[model samples]
Target: MEPSVFTRIVRGELPAAKVYEDEHTIAFMDAGQVNPGHVIVATKRQVETVMELDDELAAAVFRTAARVARAVDRAYQPEGITLLQANKPAGWQTVPHFHIHVLPRHEDDGVTLGWPRKNPTLEELSVLARRIEVKD
Candidate 1:
């Protein structure tokens, strides 16, 4: 399979405004910045989704994201911040690579994310939760 855009960036075959990197992850400014401090933190392994990552690699990705978020907060001092991670196309994941978007947010920034609430009852919620609850 061809490498995703992120893979090329990681391999130095493409240009990116890189901000942070480690053995397991790399972070860079997003080409289409929703905000001034918008950045993407991705796994170096080139996995397409978070489900493909083992616990350790997944944790590393979030660790780097948190680190970059702090830096972005300090540098940009936005009114708020958003950490977004999407899965498949249905989940709004345009790029196949697993990554997190650290977005510095402000009022009326034009970004909108909303979903209708189901408002299931307590018993109904419990039943649904039990269906997918993790078991050791």
Candidate 2:
């Protein structure tokens, strides 16, 4: 597999404010942080999302993210933490690789994740759920 920005960081191909690294994933400080102690955890492989990842790889990445988040929490002591992983362009995935953003939340921080809520009727929900449940 070709190297990603994350893979490069793991291999020291690129310079990053890295905090954690393991065989499967790497966690680094986000240069453009929305809040203090913001971090990004990413896999060395190029899978774009959880659905694209095998179970073992996905578990590894998630575990790395959790560990990083715990440390960030202890270090920064933010009121909360937000873990975000978007898939594909339509879902606002900027990179073609998998990553989990660990955003430390603070009341004074300007970061906001807002979307207009749309509640579907029970019948609509049932139809959508059934359609999604039918795996190939």
- Across residues 13-52, which tens digit of lDDT does each residue of candidate 2 receive? 8899988888888889987888879999999877766788
Clashes by residue pair, model 1 = none
Tell me the tens digit of each residue's lDDT in model 1 across 57-136: 98899999999999999999999999999999999999999999999999999999999999999999889988895643
- The regions of model 2 sitting more than 4 angstroms off are 1-3, 134-136
The count of residue-pair clashes in candidate 2 stands at 0
Each candidate structure's TM-score, on Cα atoms with residue i matched to residue i, is 0.97, 0.90
Regions more than 4 Å wrong, model 1: none
lDDT of each: 0.95, 0.85
Instruction: Show pairs that collide, candidate 2.
Output: none
